[model samples]
Target: MITWMQRHKKWLVITIWISTIAFVGAGFVGWGSYDYGKSSGAVAVVGDRKISVEEYQREYSSLYGQYARAYGNQFNQEMAKKIGLPEAAVNLAIQKNLILSYADDLGLTVTDEDIAKELVKMPAFIKDGKFDKELYIRVLTQNGTTAVAYEKSLKRDLLLQKVESLFDINPSSNEVNNLSKLLFAQDDLSIQILDPKSIKIDYDDTILRDYWNINKIKYMSTNSYELAISKLPFVTVSPTEDELKEHYSKFKTDYKKEDGKIKSFEEAKDDMIKVLSIKATKKDALKKYLALKKDEMKFDATTVIFEDKLPFSAENINEIKTATVGDVLKPFEGTDGFSIVKLIKKIDPKPLAFAMAKDMVKADYLDIKRSEKINNIAKEAMKDFKGEHLGFVSRTSIDKIKGLNPNEAYGFLNKLFMSKEKEGRIDLGEKVVLYKINSSKLGTDTTTQEKSVKDILLRLQKEELMTSLIKNLENRYEVTSSLDNKE
Candidate 1:
């Protein structure tokens, strides 16, 4: 099955970075301030606009709390700090502000009715088939949301979604079909792999001594110290009761509602009417487009015999049979969207006979047989290996294991680590050659205390490398933070 990311690669890449920051607490930070009248302190200031400190703290707390719930005991303050949770929250705030600003600039507006309709779709706010005001209030209150504030946020979100949809243009059918084929095409290759163990490595004690001496600095021990760290207090102004009341009053219009059972006709009547209208319009549009296409092709559908029932109207079936090049069918509602399908060509579906499918089955069988053969070859190659030192090593430490292929090191790490000390070779099926471990250590030496220092340095180096790579990629992309730009 194709993943959501695979289906929407461009959008996935754009949105995933922001999502990652919200979840993993790692990414960009921007200078910005949020202002909500008299109760505001600079959370961050992008340009002239201020993001309130309270708002920043609220967003951070919610995000981090969610991460803790998902990760459970693994979530710790140290991990949060390491992943730059504060920075992530700031970046998310900037992104949100930017998107909202863009929507405002474009004069995009979402009506109160639009928000209400969207709210009905939220499972938490719904009971049976109707929107449940009590459940809605309860959930929002539990999440520290005031009715007015939550609605404003929801409105902003809806506006952003509208703007995003405006940019959601569909590719031409030819383009979509070409892309689909590229994505779904399968390749069959007859591959032969040579086991690395088949290559001999000459090991001499003198050579080991010489190599160890020249690279002794790389294996040195250093003094180590363990220390405990604690967080220091940072000052922040607290909101008074009067201030909270004032803030609530200013935004209260967003939350005003009447109590009692809502008649669907009264609450969602407009929404239902709009939906029905759109459906009717689409049906009419399709019928008109199909009639035009049928006239162009001058073809009759009476000759074509469909073995199975088609999920289309009689007019739609005629349209498909008569569709010619360059004619566009009206959009028909599908699971994802209103699909405007162009009949490229109608190829008759035929059931594969036994003889027709025989070659395909034979090919699949041979592929499996080849994989098994590769595994057997690897086992036979390592039958006589013996060494004083053995055991599992990290994939990155392939150099430490003699007569091993660095390229295939990752495949063997788990097997080598899990292997019990034995005389014979360990066989990993399907071209993966395994190594036997005679002895093992945690890559640590208690006697010298030097191994710990070396390990720490190595870990730090790898982390630094990863950080640099991420920075380079981020720099290459034009990452604009609304938190910094919004006035």
Candidate 2:
């Protein structure tokens, strides 16, 4: 079922024309930011259509805001760059423009009546189960979009949907039947596993030094920081039962047992008290931070490593990284209490000398040597099995193999199913398995096979049609992007 969903998801994305505002607004944080020229609001020109800065900004903000809320301080500029959010934003805009451009070339146009009908049917634009013009206008205004612009966007989306729906790649009954047999077929296998750790490798100072010289960058020093930190302990504030109960009432749903039953106030009293105490301490911590900023309060400073030695979190470390020396960050909750942290010093990352990184280099060298040795062992094992020295076991699911870890079992099973060779030795880091298939048979359950195949065939059709349509349309239309020069 999980595999079926994974296969069908792309088809669903291609076919469904969801609510425009909601689709654009949701997960916009996944795209970073794009800059259209200040002189013109357009970011990119596709054929005759222009993608506006307003549209880009709106979608980017929505997507980034969602990530920020979910990730807290973890979603920094560096993280955004690593995820290619900016490029993703531009691609999304380009895809939209491509569809719209194709629609325009085909002379597709939506009437005001068509837009009106769609708008009225949308629950977001309706009040009292009926169309409400005032409500619609107000909602659009609140989202920083005008009714005219939104309507225009919606019309384009509908036209694009109409164009996309024209292609069909649905399979025949015979095709489904053949596909079903392939999908439901199960292979019976005989197997033996070899442990990599059983083999040993010897290492000396010379070997370690040589390894360090080649991979010195891997042994680089992380950024370090000097910080002046003061704590506002949450236990200092005593939260009364009444206050705790009030806080509990506001967030009662969160206090749930393993059985899904809501934990009573009595069951959650201790936790509530601690949380309320922390909430009160946050105010005092802020006051302390303000005084620290003004140099009215003194804090004991300590040198801390920015990466592995962090007393707070990666998110807080990133925040500190952005701050200049002498800048004080506001109070944040840590393991013990609310903390006010001031940036006292910053250290840039640098590679360690070979002498200093010898131990780590030795460990890495051993890991590489062991992996190589294991691969060689597996190859030899395969040769021996082919020579018939090793006896084969009966048929069993790859997952049901004795003594293999769950992760290794699933991974090996997936690999075995994907492999073309009937007999081979698979290397799985910790252990290697030698496998040989005796027979393969399709599933006997007709109803399950038919239903699964039908669904898979439909998904394949949708995917094939979508891919062909995109390629044909892209070539058919003139496409251009100013993504390289977003500013």
Candidate closest to the true structure, highest lDDT: 2
**lDDT for each residue of candidate 1 in 341-385, tens digit (9 for 90 to 100):** 454445444444434444444444445556566656656755664
lDDT, candidate 2, residue 453?
74
Error of 2 at 251 (Å): 28
Alpha-carbon TM-score of each model against the true structure:
0.39, 0.62
lDDT tens string, model 2, 1-487?
3345335423323233223434423322212244455725677777788887766664455545545565666665555544555665566666677777777777888788887777777787678889988987776654446777777667766776676666645678878877776665677667777775666789889878888878788998888888888877776557777877788879875564433245688998876776667777787888888888899989865656646677776567778889899889988788788888888888888999888788788778887898898777667777856422223221225446766887888778778777899898777876878888877776554556687679778766776766676678678767777776543
Model 2 misplaced stretches (Cα beyond 4 Å): 1-32, 37-40, 58-78, 194-355, 386-407, 429-431, 449-453
lDDT of 1 at 1: 15
Query: With candidate 1 superimposed using the best TM-score fit, by how many Å does residue 146's alpha carbon deviate from the native?
Result: 1.5
